[model samples]
Target chain A: MMIDHPLPPGSTIGILGGGQLGRMTSVAASRLGLKTHIYNDTPDAPAFDVAAAATVGAYDDLDAIARFAEQVDVVTCEFENVPAAALEAAGRSACVFPPVKSFEVAQDRLTEKDFVSGLGIAVAPYAAVATLADLKGAILRVPPPALLKTRRFGYDGKGQASIHTLCEAESAWEIIGEAPAILEGMVAFEREVSVIAVRGQDGTMRFYDVVENVHRGGILDTSTVPANMAPRLAGEAQAIAGRIAEALGHVGVLTVEMFQTGGASPSLAVNEIAPRVHNSGHWTQDACLISQFENHVRAICGWPLGDVARHSDAVMTNLIGDDAGEWRQNAAEAGTALHLYGKAEARPGRKMGHITRISPKS
Target chain B: MMIDHPLPPGSTIGILGGGQLGRMTSVAASRLGLKTHIYNDTPDAPAFDVAAAATVGAYDDLDAIARFAEQVDVVTCEFENVPAAALEAAGRSACVFPPVKSFEVAQDRLTEKDFVSGLGIAVAPYAAVATLADLKGAILRVPPPALLKTRRFGYDGKGQASIHTLCEAESAWEIIGEAPAILEGMVAFEREVSVIAVRGQDGTMRFYDVVENVHRGGILDTSTVPANMAPRLAGEAQAIAGRIAEALGHVGVLTVEMFQTGGASPSLAVNEIAPRVHNSGHWTQDACLISQFENHVRAICGWPLGDVARHSDAVMTNLIGDDAGEWRQNAAEAGTALHLYGKAEARPGRKMGHITRISPKS
Candidate 1:
C-alpha cells in the first residue's frame, strides 16, 4: 500500500482484533504518543484493560469498522486470521498496512504456496484438494504420509489433519469441515524457524535473525535465536524471508515460518507467512534493538522503519497455562527476559507469559 | 531499613514527579500488570496521560502525601528530589521502597559524600558549608576549583555554583539561593559511568552492565553499554551500586552514577544515586532482557525482579532539544531503538527522546 511521509504522533492507530497482540501494539503506540483504537469481536479480551478506545464488535460490523477506520490515520491487524471482509472494510478508509495482497497470500494455504513458489521460492511438495476424491488423488501424487490443511484460518495445529495412508483420507477431509484444502508432502526437517521482516511504504525492508521455533501440540512453546545452526542455512532462511517480504511489497512485520532441513547440504523451506507480528517474533522485543511491534507500528504509520539489529543472541520461551506459576523463578533470572501477556486466566494451553534469555556473546 | 519477600504485582507504585518520568513509570507499571498512582504537584503533568491516578498538590503537602500513600500498596518515587518531609509523610502510611534514607542521601551533597565514605565506599573529596565562613574553610581543605551545590531540592543544573577561590565564595553561595550547601573538590576523571541495578523488596538484586555516560551541561547526553571498561572496574562499580542499594534498603531500579578516576588501574567513586529509574538506564528498555522501568515496577509493586541481563551491547543517545529532529534518521537505522518522551517542545537541552542501538555479536 502507498503511504505518505511522516504520519505524525497523536494519530490514532486502528487496530483490528483485541488480543494480547493488540494490547501490546496499543502500549507501543501509546509510548510514541500515538493513540490506538481496538476493535474486536470478543468483549472480554485482555487487550481491553489498557486500550484507550475500544469497539466491542464483530469484524463484520461494517458500521463500526467504517467509523473506526475513518477515525484513525492508519490501519493494522494484530492477527492474520482477520476476515478479508473486515480487512477490506478497514482498507476502504485507512491504508491497511501489509496490504490486501498479504492477506490474500496468507488466507489460503494453496495460494500462499503458489505465491511463494511463483517467486522461485522453495516450498514443500503440495497439491490442492476440493473434494474427497481430490484428496485421494493428491495422496497418490505425493505419498501416504502427508498432511491436509484447510486453505483458510488455521493456526496452532487446528484446521489441519495428518494422513498416514489413504484409509484416513475421507475422515481427515471431513474433520477439516470440508473447506478448501492442500495436501503437502512433509520435508525431512531438523528444526522449525521463523524470520520476522519489516517492509515500509517506501520500499525499505529489514530482516531480523532467523529464530528457531519449537511447537508443543501445534502451539509455539519456544523460539531461540542464533538458530544454533550453520551460518549458510541461517542466511538462506533470512534471505527467503527477505525475498518473500519484498515480493509482496509487504509492510509491517512479516513472519515466515520455515523448516530447516538440517542435513549434509543443510537447507530451508517456507511453511507459511504471518502477515502481522506473530508469536514467534515476541523474542525480538527483548533480544533485538528494534522490536517487531515497534517496526510494525513504524511501517504501518508511514514512519521510517527502525533497525532490525540483534544485540544479544537470545532464547524466548512461552509460558502456557500452569507454566505461568514459574513467573517468580523466571523474573528472578537476573538476565532472563520475561513478558506476561496480561492474560488473567492460565487456562490449559493458554499463553500467559514468556521469558527471553539474551546472551550478548558466547 | 530492611525488606523481605518481594512485594507482589497488582500493588501500587508511587511516583514523585508528574512529568515524563512519572508518565513512563505508569506506562511501565501498567505493562507489568500493576497499578500506578503518580504523586506529583501538577495536575496537568505529562504523566497524567498514563497513570491510574495522580495527586496534584505540593510535594510538601503532608495531607496530600498521607492520603496518596494510604491509597497505594507500596510507594516509589519518580524523581529523586522529592522533599524529605513528603517522604516521611508517605512512609507513615505506606511501605516506601528506597526508604527515606535515599532521600536524605540525595537531598544533601555533604550527607551523600559522608554516607558513601561511611560505608567505606569511594567518593570525590568534599566538605560541608553551613556558612560563608564554612565555605572558605571547606575550600581551604579541598583547594581551588571546587563545586558548591545546594543541600536540598536541586536539579537540572539548578542549585549549583562553581567556585574557583575564596573571592567567589559568597556569590557562589548566593547563586544557590544562599541555601545550605556543600563544596566539593573537582573529580578529575577520565570518564563517568553508572550502574543501573534493581533490588527486590526481598533484598535480591540484579545489575545491568556498567554504562559509560556523557553529560552535556549537567544533563545526561549519552550512555554507551559495555562501556569499554575493564571488567574488574565494572565489577567494582556494580559492587558499589549493590552496597548503596543495600544500605538504603532500596527496592526497585536505582542508578549509581560514578566517576572512573583513571584509565589504567581505574577506580570508581560514587557521584550520586538516583533512587528511582534514572534517565541513564533508559537504554534498558531495548538493550536488556528486562527494562529498568518494568523491573522497577516489579520491584516496588511486590512482583519478582526481572533479569537485569542485557541482550546486546548497546549505545543510547538522548534526543536533547532539537536533536529529536534526527528522530527520522534514528528511526530509519534498521534496529535503532527510538523512545520519544511525549514532550511537545524541542527546547534547548530538553530531553525530548532517545535512540538506542544494540549491536549483535560478530
Candidate 2:
C-alpha cells in the first residue's frame, strides 16, 4: 500500500503503548524533529517521561483513543497486544501502520502458526486447544514433550506450561487457566535466532543482520550479532522475515523469531512473529548506521529505510531485576553503551535496562 | 574537584538556554534514563518540544533559575552567554559543570586570548580597542590586515569588521557600534581545525579526533574528521585543549578552535575557546564511540568518561536557510544521517539542521 504523503519534521506521531520500546522510539522521533504522544494504561509509564504528550488510559477506551488518533498525523504501536477494537477506532481517523490483520495473526499462537505454515514456511506441529476435551484430543496428535500456551496475552514465558507426558495434559490446561490455547510439538532446537526487518509504506523492505538470542528463566538475557551460523541458515531466516513482512503488508519494523534445529544442515523453523521492534535487535542502536527504532519511525512516516549495515561486532546484555545495581561498574567500562528504561521498580525478572558493548570488526 | 556523589538514573538534568544543542542533549540524557528540564527565553524553543519540563523566562530571572536548580540534581548550559548571575544563583542550589570561571574567561575574546596565552599557548597578537581613539592606537601595535571584533556577544562573524588599513579605523569603530573590541593581527593560516575534548568532575580528560572545518560566509559549513594535517599540529591542538580544560577546571565538553599556520611544520595558534559543546563537534554524535552530548552528561554527573575513539571517517554539513527543503533527498542517500531542528521557519542563514555521512575506516 502506498502512503498518501510523508510526514514532515513537526508532525506528531501517536504511539499505542508506553513501554521501553515506546520510550526509545520517542527519542528517535525527537531526533528527526517529530513529536510523539504516548498512550498507556499505567500512570507511570516510562515512555511518558520523554514523549511530547501522553495519556494514561486503557487501549479499549474508544473515546480516549479517538481523541489521540485525531490529534496525531499517524498511529503506530509498540506492542502486538494492542486491542483490535482500539486499532479499528484509530484506523477510522488516522493512519495505523502494520494494519489490524498483522496484529490479528500474531495475537493468537494457533493463527500465527497457521498463517506461517500456509506460506509454505516450516512450523512446529500445533493444534488449537479451547477446552480440556480439546487438550485431550490435541495430546493424541501433538503428543507429550510439547508446550501448551494460552492463545492470547502471553509473553516472557508467562501463560504457558510444558507437557512432559499425556498424564499432565489436564494439569497443563489448568495451568493456563482453561483459556483458549495451542499445543505445539517440541522441536529439538540447538539455538534461537531472530531477524529484525522493516518495510516502508511504499513496499521497500530491509533487514538487519540476524542475531543469536539467549534467554534466562523465560526472559531475554543476551543478543549477539554474527550469529556464527551456517550462511545458508542465516539467509533462510532473513528470507522468512522478508516474506512475512510482505505478506502482512507491514509498514514498520517487525521481528521473526526462529528455531535452528540441530542437524548437519541446521534447518530453521518458524517460531513466532512480532509486529514491532524486538528486544533481540537492540544491538543495532550502537553497531549500525541506523537503529531499528529510527527505521520504524522512517517506515511509518513514509520515508526511505536508512542504511542498516553494521560496521562493528556487538553484544547486547539485558539488565534484569537487580542487575542494574552494577550500573556504576558498567558505566566505568570503556565502549559500553548503557541504556536504562527509567522504570521505578526493579522487581525480580523485570527488565530494568540494557548495555551494549561494541568493537570495530577486523 | 571531586563530586560527593554521582547523579543516578532518573535524576533531573536542568539545561539552560534551549536550542538545537539543548534538544539533542536532552535526547541523549533520556537515553540514559535521565529527565531534563529546559529553560529558555522563548516558549517556542525547539528543545521545549522534547524536554520533560520547561520554563519560559529570561536568564536574569533568578527566582525561576533558582527554582529550576532546586528541582534538578545538576545544572548545565548550552551556550556560554548565559548570565553570570543566573549561573551563580543556580550553582548555589545544584551542581553546575564547567564552573562560571571558565565562562568568564571564554565569554570575552580578550580574556580568552589572555588566559590561553598565560598557559604558554600561542595566541593571535592582539590589542584592546574601547573607542575610535583606542582603535587608532591599537593599529600601531596590532598593525594592518587585522580584525576588530567585539570582546563579548560575538559569534558566527557577527559584531566584527576587518581593518585592511589604518585609514579604516574610524569606519570600523562605527561598524562595530563603538563597542569594546579586540584588534588581532591576522595569521596566514592554511586551514582551521577544532579539538573537542571533555573533562570529568574527577579531573579525568579525553579528546576526540581532530576535525577540519570549512566556513561559508563566516558560518560553519562543513566539518570533516581525519583532518589532513601534520601529526605534530594535531597533537599540539589536543594538548592545548587539554591544558585549557585543566586550567579552567572544566567539568564538561569544551572546544578549542585553532589556526594551522602555513609553514614547513605548520604550527598552531589558538583562535578561540568555547566553554560548552561546540557545533564543530556535531560529527562526534555519529563518528565516535560516545557522543559529545553523552560525554557532557556523564561529566556533569560525575560518571567516568566514555571512550573517545572514531571507527569511521565522517563529514558533517550544516543545513542552513532553505537547505532543509532537500531533506528527503538527504534522507534517501546511503550512509547519510539527517537531523532536523523543529524550527517552524527557515529564515536566511538560520541553521535548520545538519547531516553527517560516514564511511568505515580502512
Candidate 3:
C-alpha cells in the first residue's frame, strides 16, 4: 500500500497511547499545524491536555479504533504494547508507522532478542520458558545468576526477577506468574547506552547522538548525550541500530539499547529495543534542532526528516514521584528546561517529569 | 500588593484572549507543567485546540470572568485590548500581570503616545482630535502630511487615514467616524526595531536582543534579530524600553517598537508599545534559550526570569494567508523551524503561521 505524500497542515494525526510521549508528540504535531487525537483507555490521560481531541476507549474496541483511524491521515503509537486488533483496524483505515511487524517483534522478549540476533547483532544468550521443565533445562546452558523475564507486557523493573541459584529459579518463575517467559544470561558490562534512530517512509534513516543511560531501581534516571564511550564504539552502536531498523522496515523512531562489553576495544551487545520515541531521547528536545517527537511526526506524515545536529551538550534527569515537588527550584535555575507531565497524582516510582540542562558547545 | 513567591506545577493559568499568541503561550505553559484555560468569545478559537480548558464567553460577561479567574492561579493577557471590566473582575479573584495601567496606556493611540512622551522618550508630534473641528485645528499644528488614527480599537493600520491637505481633513474625520482620534506627524526613519522585555513579579527584569521588523500593508512581515544598526544605538533603544517597562511597573512581556531616524549615530523615536508578547519577538522562539512566550509564562507564574541570551542569529518570516502552503518546503529546509497556528482557513492577509531560520553562532 502506498502512503500519501506530505500531509497537509490541517490534517489530523492519531496517537494510540495518551502518556507523556503522546503528549509531547501531540505538542510537536501542533507546532506543524497538524492536529492530534489521542486514543487511550485511561481517563484523564496527560495527552488529553495538549491534544486537539481525545477518546477514552478500550484498545480492543474495533469500532472505536476504526472511527479514530478513519478520522486521521496517519496513525502512530507511543508504546509497543498496542493490541494487534487495534493496529489491524487502524492499518485498514490509515497508515501505521513502525508497522505491525515491528510491534509483533518488540512486544515479546524472546522475539525481540531473536530478531536482533537474526540481524547478526550480538545479544545475551536466551531460551524460551513456557514451563518449569523449560526453565530448568534452559538454566543448564544459560547458567545461573540469569534474568527470568515475562515474554510479554512488562516494563521498567516489573515482570522480571533474578535467579541467583538453581533453588531460586522456581521462586523467580512463581514471581513472574504463569506468563510465558525467557531466561537470559547476564553480561558484565562497563556502561549502558542507547541509539535513537528514525526511519522515514521512503526508507531514509537518521540517528541522533548516542546517549549513556543510568538506571536506579530498574528505572531510567539520567541520560547524557555524547555518551562518554569512545567515538568508534558510538559509531558501531549507530551501525547496529541502523541495521536493525532496516531489517524491521521500521518507520518512526526506533531506540536500540545496548551494553558496552569488554574493555580497551569495547563492543556493543544488544540489550533490547523500543519501537517508539524513548525516554532516553528526551534530551534531544532541548539540545537538538529537531526533537525525536517532531521527527516521529514528520516520519509518519511522509514529510522530510529535519536536521539532527546537536548544538549543545545536555544531561536529562527524570523526576519520579516526589522528586517533582522541587519543580519550583528547577524553574528558577538557569540553563534548565523543565517539563512536567501534568499527572494528577505523584504515585511512588511513577514518572512525573524531566529536566534537561544544556551547555552550548564552545 | 505583594505577589506570591512561586506558582507550583499543575496550577492553572488563565489567558484573557485566544489567538496565535495565546496558542503559543499555552504550549509554553504546558511545557512547564502548568495547565492553561483560554477565555475568548470566538467559537473554536485556535488557542482552544491546545489549551486544557476553554470558555467561549464575552469578555464583558462579569459572571464568566469571575468563574474563570477563580479557577486559575494567575491571569495574563495575550493582547493589550483586554476590557477594563474583565480585568477588574479577574483582579478580584486572581493576580493579573501588567495590571490595568499597562492596558489603559496601550489601548489608546493618543494615550500611548502621551505616556511615552511623558516618560521623556522622543515620539512623533501628535494632537488629540475629538471632532471635525478638532481635526481641522490639530492638522494645522501637527502638519498637513500626517496620520489620523482612532484613539481606541485600532490595529493593523485599521481605523486611520492619511491627511495630505486641508481638503483631506474632513474625509479623514469621516473615515475615522465618531471615535476620538490622534493626529500625528510622520517620522523620517531608516528602519524599525523592537525590544522584548519581561519584568518578574519580584521586579527582576530581562530583555532579549532587539529585533528589526519589516511590515507590508501594516502587517508584520519579517523580524530579524541583531538589527544592522550600530551597537551603541541598539543599547540606547534597550534603555528606553527598560525605562518604559519600569515606569509602568509592568510584568510579563513588554515590546517597545522604535524607529531609527537620521544617520551617523542614528537616534530612535518611540513608535508604539505592545504590553504582551509581540509579533516582532517571535524570532526569539528559535534563536534564544528562553523564548518570549516562556518568559511571559515565567513572569506571571512568579518564577525567576529565564536566560534570554541569543545563541543563534535568526530571521522570522510570517506565512500570511496562502503563504502557509509552502510548509512542506519550509519543513524540508535545514535550520528552519516552522510554526503553524492550526487555523482552519487561509483567509487573505491572515497570519497563518511563521518560519524561523536560525544560524548557530560560531
Note the clash tally of each candidate.
Answer: 16, 0, 0
Writing each residue's lDDT as its tens digit, candidate 2 over B269-291 gives 99999988889999988887689
Q: What is the Å distance of residue A262 in model 3 from its true position?
A: 2.7
Q: How are the candidates ranked when ordered by TM-score, highest leading?
A: 2, 3, 1
Model 1 residue B338 CA deviation (Å) reads 2.7
In candidate 3, how many Å is residue B59 off?
2.8
Find the 10 residues in a row with the least total lDDT in model 2 chain A.
A1-10
What's the true lDDT of residue B45 in model 3?
Answer: 82
- Model 3 CA deviation exceeding 4 Å by range: B1-3, B164-167
Ranking by lDDT: 2, 3, 1
Using all chains and alpha carbons, the TM-scores for the candidates as numbered come to: 0.88, 0.98, 0.96
Q: What is the TM-score of chain B alone in each candidate?
A: 0.93, 0.98, 0.98
Which candidate comes out best when scored by TM-score? Answer: 2
RMSD of 3: 2.0
lDDT of 3 at B241: 89
Question: What would the per-residue lDDT of candidate 3 be over residues A76-123, giving only the tens digit for each residue?
Answer: 999999999999999898988879889999999999999999889999
Error of 3 at A184 (Å): 2.5
